[model samples]
Target: MRNVSSPYLLEQLMSRLVAPDAPRLYTNGQPWRDARGRGAPRHAVETEFKAEHAVVDLSTQPPKPLVVKCLVRELRIRFYAVSTIKNYRSAWVCFLRWYRGPLDQIDQEDIREYLELLVAGGASASEVSVTLSALRTGLDKFCLLRCTVGLVSPRKSKQLPVVMSKKEVQRMMEAARTLRDKLLLTVLYATGLRVAEVARLQWSDFDFDRQQIRVQLGKGKKDRYVMLADDLLPLMRQLWRHTKGVGYLFPSEGRRVDRHLSPRTIQRAVKQARILSGIGKAVTPHSFRHSFATHLIESGTDIRFIQKLLGHTNLETTSLYTKVARMKATAVASPLDRLRDEPGSSSESSGRQPKPRPSVGRMRLEVDPNPDSNGAYAVTLGVWKDGQLLPLPGMRATMPRQDWVSLQIPLQDIWEPTLRCLPTAQRERLESPEFFSQLQREVAKRILRIRDAEPFQALKT
Candidate 1:
């Protein structure tokens, strides 16, 4: 080495000696001499001239380490919310590891790549959406600019709601093992209140004297009055006695002492009751709402009235139950049956005598598992035959109406479910003139449909 007085060249050489494995940079091949005329060693010259450099070691103090705590504290002092602070700190920490450099060196591209990796790793739509929101919020607050965040739109799938008949609903309520569970399902059906609304109900919502239930802020932030069924009044009185002290109408364990049971807890109870009832339908807390709508439609209540009671914003939403409630056309006595039975009618006059009277087929009036105080009665009109009573393949029978003509059957062999066991008045009204006329009209309609279908199905050659 040539002895020179260049202190800068001597400093560069000394700096290289600190990390012998580090590649050389700016090797101006000349040695510099010290003030005393003796060449200073590389290590001694570097130590004397170069600024302090801290070496990083887990066991020892770091040399010139970036203070992450200082950066985070400064961010917090800037009035960042707790959640924002957490999100920003997390993103920053990730950035440090990703680039392995000081915070100042990380760029927008680094953030983009990290997010892309997150998506590539198969994140769910909701999860990815949340993470994107967090990252965007963090960048805007701390980085002072909106970064390139991916667009993730949430999509909703269409699903038809579940409904239950009034009969099926009764079965489910009866299956309920506890008083609390029974009333829970009853309120759900009666008021058409959502599980959440029912859970949040207060004892004051029920006005016993007026026989009305006040549903406060029901679905869609609407309030409505639901009539209390007369049959349920006794049950309600008993329930009130036991639940008098509780702040919530349906209080349960783990809920706040002042608050009611959770919507999910009520839903679970309904699910269990449905399973035990052995009625094969997906009966949920909302099933009561469906049954309420269906039963109201079946009872000849106006759809508009039902819509208001249900708190439905649109009438169309309430109209779906109309299709589910079987509308019975006027019953018709089959001309064939009437003809064969009439003593001098042509059916008997033709070739052979009338065949042996076959067994009367099953009755159609379905029993309501949970009937109201009023007797359960809903009329149905379907085809009937005389020779051997052949039942409708797909349909079940509706309640026998006052207009239906009942031939007096000998009490020896058969017991009719439709006919109330009554003496003079009840027996006389079973087959009225109005009932026979209604039957004739319905039979004419069926005959017209049969005629129209025959022509339509016939192929034109």
Candidate 2:
């Protein structure tokens, strides 16, 4: 490897592999050590020239021009982030290909053809918007203001959101296999929380006594309070106990205390749940949020209250639920039945049939470890049915009402036990006064820690 020279800077660019400390002019190997030979190596050169034509080893291509590399380096130093660097570079690279060479030599006609090429290639509105912006920014910075790269505009297309119904919501919820999964789904629906908002929820955000959840820096970077369901409070307390030492509510794998569960994990969970639910309609975690707003309005909850809960910047955005909310029966005739009564009406010939009623099974739940303040000692009564494990209760009603058992296990005990033994199903068992008190104590400890977390300090910035 010999030193390469810069055409623009007129300075020798030594290859670190060869001249680790000194400069050497760009030339074929050794600069022909015996310069008096028939083909004397060209030296004493100090003029700008394209070196791409220079002879070199058959191996790598010549390094990029120092001017171009410096341009890219300066682009980064100007606070144009890396993503911007790649995008702008990519856009200009396309422009270079369009004009065929020497981009500064290209005029308005070349740029217009390039924009036409982009549109003819079927780029979407958003993609074209990004590409045009990238091109404009690059040209503007590189003194190509006379170029017509700015003339192109993006295509416009209307996109409507998919909505879900109540039954679909129920199916999605039922698909969640674990208590944690179920609670996560519930919070998304119950609070109308965006996926990111849910991932960022800290233990300190919850107010157990007030039954309210304070969402800090929600969508549009605003804070608001959402009402917490009384039913979820006790379960949350048990979860707090399970994740006592964890920094984030849903900690990432490998027990990295400061890391929260990634948003993609929750998104995947929602996607799987949707598929398992056999839902025909297209739905997303956001559909749950939409459903939450629609359901509240259908139930006659005040629109203003729903707005506050959803943390919408504008009331009109919240009001979209009005159109989606399902209407209750109000002496309305069945349109399908009316079809049977048309001019060709005949109940016998129409083959009208009575609807079958579905059987509702009793909601069953059983306590295995029994109620406990610490919530550390508990296994699902149902899990015992697996012959290798604890015995299962046949029915929730038959399980012993033996009063709440206090859990005094050390923190290490919880971690020491195999996850198989840490029964999460028991967490949902009937709540006890003692358990709530324990939760209050834990909340106090969490609040103090949150006040001192590094993120809290950064928030001041």
Candidate 3:
């Protein structure tokens, strides 16, 4: 007997240990040694690779250990993720060590006990769930029958993602120690990109003329476009000039200059900024993405549009942010507060308040629905002259122009916009005579009164 000095030889030996109906007698760890204690005993346990028919299920029906070759073959055929394959392989290897008996004799009750052992050994619920999933994938989906069927693992606690306030996000950027780190944080929040998606961003993905960033090959192997904030365009142009506009958006630190920045690096940058900005929450890089979605939800952005920007496959995934949205535009006042002599302000308790909607007379204007940019929309106000609503001379250009300007946002049903909501979508719609007529009626609703109007101002004009 000689000590197996070669790892290749050991791998070959390990692979052959699981043969059909063979007693797994070698405890490779118990130190099988000769009289000289120089090496393993001469007793040769069969070390050979044998092929078996790929069976669908071995649950409560197999007499031997898991067919390693069959499992590996099945894994490759299905093209599972590399990490998933590694986890599945490790799980069964450990399971085989724990249960020396034939795998067919094992039942659901035994699997449950093993999971309990894992829990007792200080594994988190998530870890146990992952292990259980691996078992189901290897034992049932790939290798044989579902050895893990009907066995329930503990549910992981649902925790909402931490979101930084818009101001906090700004502070984080300002707090960034380096220009590259600052830009990375900006792109992350602006696009609602996953850390990995942002890491893989290349120079060509940015389309300045169209004002959109192409997120390439995101989760689930999908791609989507996100808006580039006009305010941040100048910063990006500077970056383009610095890099001569070629290669990955996030450059790698290693000698291989062509490689994109790693996700871990982006995360490290976020952490550094988060600490410098003094935010107390668990502000990982993903938090910025959560903040991005939550902020969009708070703004009047439509959920469906948000779903597209976030590259979410389902509307439900996009809707999760609605739960965390402050809904500042439509924060409802509690009925109890209305009964009080002075209503309690939500801002006073929370250090913030919902923005007041612009209003005119009694008419509540809708916020501009057009989302081409996050720019301010100049408002047009029709002057009431001689009982006729008329545009004043140079008024559209100068007077009252700034007075009615409002940012477009959606309000909850409880709170409606009070200002003659001028939409910036089309300038012609504002000038049309019909526009004034509808506005007049909307204002009349707020006042709960109606008045007849004559054409005195039309004659003057």
Encode model 1's per-residue lDDT on 1-461: one tens digit a residue. Answer: 67757998778668866776655454564454445645654444432211122111212222222434544665566765565567656655554455554433335676667767766888655545555565454443333333534444434343456778767888788666466777889888878877888898887887888988898876655789988788777777767776763577788655457767878889887986776566677778987887888878878899999988888898888877877775645544556656667688665576676555333223342222332354332223322334332222221212233212122123322324333343344334434544443333333233333433444467442
The 10 consecutive residues of candidate 1 with the worst lDDT sum are 49-58
Error of 1 at 63 (Å): 27
Q: For residues 298-404, what per-residue lDDT tens digits would candidate 3 score against the true structure? A: 87889999988888888988888988988553568666666534546664556665666333322223322222243332233443433545432211111122112
TM-score of 2: 0.51
Give the per-residue Cα lDDT of candidate 2 at 190.
81
Predicted structure with the largest TM-score when compared to the true one: 3
What candidate 3 gets wrong by more than 4 Å, as runs, is: 1-77, 334-461
Candidate No. with top lDDT: 3
lDDT head-to-head 2 vs 3, winner: 3
* lDDT order of candidates, top first: 3, 2, 1
Runs in model 1 lying further than 4 Å from the true structure: 1-157, 254-256, 329-461
* C-alpha TM-scores of all predictions: 0.42, 0.51, 0.57
Clashing residue pairs in candidate 1 (N, C-alpha, C atoms within 3 angstroms): 54-63, 331-439, 332-439, 364-397
lDDT of each: 0.59, 0.60, 0.65
Decide which is better by lDDT, 1 or 2: 2
lDDT of 3 at 233: 76
